[model samples]
Target: MGLLIIRLITFLNSQAPETTNYHIAMTMLANYSNLHLISIGKIAKLCNVSKSTISKFARQLGFDDYLDLKDNAAFIENRFNNPLNYLSNILTSIETDGFDNYLNAVTTDINFLRVNLDFDAVDNIAKAINDYDNVAAFGLVFSESAAIDMQYKLAYNGKFIRTFQDDVIQEDFLRNAGEDTLIIILTNSGDYLTKQQIKLGTPRKDIFSKTKAKIVVISSNPVVKNFSFVDEALIFPHQTKYQTHSIMYQIITDLIVSRYRYFNSLL
Candidate 1:
């Protein structure tokens, strides 16, 4: 991987890709792909380029598609997963501006969610979670904790929510799922890579293939347009070195539960 990255850097220095955004995107891919899990859409948004332009940049790098580039990035990310190192990195950010910056960052993100998120779309997603015969939250590590949080919050309301961490258990949940099941998946990318090193989805296939389980994805990264088979995706802002994805996921979970209760009150 080091050799490949060195060669990639050399190529970027020499060839000078189509646009400045390409250069920025490739440089990020070369250095921090492992540390920061980002989607093409996030890079595009960060670079102020179109998604197609990002795809074009990947092709310039010899990948077959943008997803391939992202998968390669995930493969690289797999090696750098570290708990204490990550925690230290996040801590360093606190020194930059202290509690005020911390509070502002989180508040800004929540306001961004309130302004940009579609409540009707959220209502549709909440309705699915509320109306489903069975609901399962699937993820690993930090993401798994978010799933557990969702279950604990809703189970008090009499929702039969199941949360899974073990692969064996998740497979059982999926195999038995059907039109009645709603699966909430947590990950930066649907590729399901994480610091815990657990891969939940099958290679080259979306999870939940065996049944008609409705999928609601609350992603830590940018979700590209028209993600097939996914009924809903609530995207979190791209994590800076210090940011946490679960913060945004928690906000969404709160809104979903609150929305559910609000509607039930009308009944």
Candidate 2:
């Protein structure tokens, strides 16, 4: 789910049932498809509240204004409507393939990665971690989790890596980043540069352009290498739709840290 939907759900959970704000949030979620078109006056009428109350409710949910809320609602609408981005796509794959067959396919993909992964690139990234004092990793959803994993693991070796769950906060970090910092972007597919949206539900225009940090992308999509800001790209084999990059990312993180420690031991 996108940020707006998640915020609405959180609001619903914390609220008592059948209240004004609760009713408004519920209405917004129930009519998620047309949320962008639902004007503040209309929602206020539907929830039997004043327009000012609706505006306050929007702010309570962390939106700058009613229009900002609508923009984010539109983004949520587009994201859930797309079958390719839906979480249930994995469930459908599991049902069709059966559990055993799905496991076998994942095993095969793991073995393929084992045989095909570029050790030189992995070692180079490990070295980069040692060479740079400031490093950060970023991605969307599962990719974001991988970034957190990288940060946690690297800390054991006296290296600190930055990561953020909020797109706005991540953008703020990138805005001030300089050549002294290294950025590692983890993407299951190479589409993050094009598809990522900020808190305002708008494309991050010139976000990378503003940063002078050295960038390295680890992804299953080879096309990430073509991006002008990227200094290095580590491409892994793409697995089936049922499988996510979680396992592969963990393996990559472990290998990089192992190599980092090996090199550090020599000192």
Candidate 3:
């Protein structure tokens, strides 16, 4: 809402620059909450804009002054911040013998899944798997096992599932892969190797551009914003250092496979 409001105002005013102050202001506001607060001039300086502009920006957003912006931004920041509400307790548990606190962390992640996982998305991916002529599963080292396991399991249950572990093999296959292919990718982070570094344009983006395959991406990375090419995405909890997140990935894999199996059985 804030971003849109600021952007809308910027657009209406038309007095803004090529790249509006939205990103600049948002970056500063993202860090400076009420508790760990800084001065308005400091924020303006950090954003590389004038104090008057900052005040005007705040006033445009209906805040009385910069202080009000800070207070409101603090609330917004806290609201959208990490949902580890039980972290303090979890830490206390670690130092002492607080087992329930530890348990709470697991349950918190479970709750995150409970809220985030859309069964309809799962069903959609499953239907695609059943409908597609070729189902290729991709995952790297940690998830390679899951992909291979899924391939074997689906094949056993009378589904021809393909696993692609090698990037060269994936690129080669994708070069020829088509709309009839359903590509399910399992990654702890949604960032694909295909989207990473390479010398040429064709080498970097070609893998995706060449394929007309429907994509299913299951990932735990919070930073992954959009899967524009993906038909269905089953996102699990954000990564945490305390817990073994591979278990979360594995659980998601199990659910998807189970759902796929059930749907397959129906057919």
Q: Whose TM-score is greatest here?
A: 2
lDDT of 2 by residue, 83-189 (tens): 54535555676787788876877787788899999999898888887788899999877788789898899888887888876566677888899999999988876
Decide which is better by TM-score, 1 or 3: 1
Supply candidate 1's per-residue lDDT for 228: 62
lDDT of each: 0.64, 0.79, 0.62
Best of the two (1, 3) by lDDT = 1
Each prediction's RMSD to truth: 16.3, 4.9, 16.1
Model 3 C-alpha lDDT per residue in residues 172-238, reported as the tens digit of each score:
7767878888888776655463453211121345366557887777777644435466667776765
Q: What is the TM-score of each predicted model, taking all chains together?
A: 0.58, 0.76, 0.54
Candidate 1 per-residue C-alpha lDDT over 79-143 given as tens digits, one digit per residue, 9 for 90 to 100:
44443233444566677668677677777777777788767766876788777767888775567
Candidate 1 residue spans exceeding 4 A from truth? 1-85, 95-102, 193-206, 222-225, 239-241
- Tell me how far the alpha carbon of residue 48 in candidate 2 is from the true structure, in angstroms, after superposition: 14
Residue pairs in collision within model 2: none
Worst 10 residues of 1 by lDDT: 193-202
Q: What is the lDDT of residue 45 in candidate 3?
A: 77
